[model samples]
Target: MIVKTSRPAARLAALVLPLAALAGMGTAAQADDWTPTSAIEFIAPANPGGGWDTLVRTTSRVIQEEGLADQNFAAINVPGGGGAVAWAQIARDTGNPHKLFATSPPIILVPLAGTSQYDHTNFTPIARLITDYSIVLVPRDSEYQDLNDLFDAIRENASLSVGGGSAPGSMDHISIAGVASAAGLEAADVNYIAFSGGGEAMTNLMGGHVEAVITGAGEAAGQLGPDSEVRALGVSAPERLGGPLADIPTYQEQGIDYTFDIWRGVMGTPDMPEEAVAYYEELFAQMLETDGWADARDQLGWIDAYQNSEEFGAFLDEQKEEFSEVLSELGLIR
Candidate 1:
């Protein structure tokens, strides 16, 4: 689930100051001191075709297209255990400056759910690149017309099942649970069925086997169009997105007073050199400034929410604590 907590502007500036200094935005010597000496390994902890895979591949493509990096980027898939397998490998490569991976809410959620031994604290945070929100959908002919309609029905009928792409207590489930709680429903009591992926969940919804499905807004976009079988009830974004998704209203717009964003970023092996972290921070900052990255982000329905290493690290800690409370509330803490 995506939650946006307000950080004071002064606090945010303080968090960013060290990263700006390391990037040589306020200095010069540091940026010249660090550059990858060989091909960089970009790891996607999930199988190809999933969100992590898309992020790693798209970032590599954008960097190469924009000439943002001098070294070749090798996108590697290390799929397993909801990122646990890759995190284990990364832990074994501590201090390896040439290795980095795509990261998101799962990095925090899965571990807290006791499915993994490694968490965000095991890695050196590089930067947070983009944010995406969850989309709640139902079959085109379903009776639920909006988020309230769906939640009201679920509340009235405890047996009604909701489905999501992630594991029971992970991203997709947590997303809807958050909204359910905000809508005055008992989040822990909501029947959530887990699917292997959003595609599978969507299939079940289209087949009339599930009451509703929650998945990434980008993933939902692929199935929603002029002649689609799924109808989006509400998105977790605070505001409406552009392009084909502009017509979909946010939960806030529908008076739900809820928001969630799935943040994706890059992080390195533990004990990675400060210089390497600084190098990636500067490289990603440059990448975000390029037209190539902007175009890629827009096409993928990603919102730009860049945060340097220090800032991203702080954000991860806050998320860990926030999610702990949420999971505990939902009785999913392991």
Candidate 2:
């Protein structure tokens, strides 16, 4: 099971900061010691229209519209090896502060799974922006009524399988494992099947290949309407999400003690200058207060989870250790 940790003070303060304070919080960044002189290359280490790409495009537009930065932020897509290709490029460009990229849990998971040579330690953390959650789904006509019922059924029938988008021991595996363990099932005993992506996982669910599907909340949003083919059993969010996800109850609300955070953030090349890091950190803290960012976050089903560099780096270390524990339980630790 995943051990939950407390949020950093910086993250807590970021959530309650008033608009006026947020506006002036970046006064320290006005120094000429470090600031982007040219257009900042904002990279999404995935194909266009994916989560990271959308975040990059949306962040660029909001920053440009809000007049947050002096230099324009240019969105770039560098897709390959599920982010390894772009990560390699960033690793080679040490100290390049102008090039920033969108990041999420895979920064840690991929490396621990032995897919990527470089990990979060190879990059300079800028700030964590928002957090998304995972959801458990079953076919609309399935007999299971909720997460507990499903776990009970799995217990009675050991052959049942839960499918997910990520490879075994990745986000999907860990998400399902976390809840299964919380539900009184052994993490290693749960039958998990991996698919290419969430779409495929959902498709297989509809086809009756898998007993259920567990995926990111936003990833499976569209198929979760009143008349949709799939219904949510429970969400891995601490609280219920907004919009289409608002109706879905969280695991805690359902008497299960579990929550999985799919945090999204920004990071720079390795050894990024401290001054440059400060500039971006302050810039993102300001972005969290923008009306555009607020709207984008709402539409994306994300929660405010801003964490400055120091807080983010510490959080990453904690997350790595936590994930390592869960991965070990599943015997897939690399």
Q: What does candidate 1's lDDT look like per residue over 1-334, in tens digits?
A: 9977667876898889888776766346654578899999999886665577778888999999989889998999887676788899999998999999999898999899988888999999999999988988998889989999988888788899998766667888788899988888888868999765565677788887889998878656666788998889998988898766888999988888889999889999999988888889999999999999888788778889999999999999999999999899888887
Per-candidate RMSD vs. true structure? 12.2, 13.0
With candidate 2 superimposed using the best TM-score fit, by how many Å does residue 140's alpha carbon deviate from the native?
4.0
| Alpha-carbon runs more than 4 Å astray in model 1 | 1-33, 156-159, 196-200, 203-209
Task: Show where candidate 2 strays beyond 4 Å.
Answer: 1-34, 37-39, 47-50, 70-72, 77-82, 139-143, 152-161, 195-211, 219-223, 227-229
**Clash totals for all models, in order?**
2, 0
The TM-scores of all predictions, comma-separated, are 0.82, 0.77
State which candidate has the highest lDDT: 1
lDDT, candidate 2, at 316? 95
Best by TM-score: 1
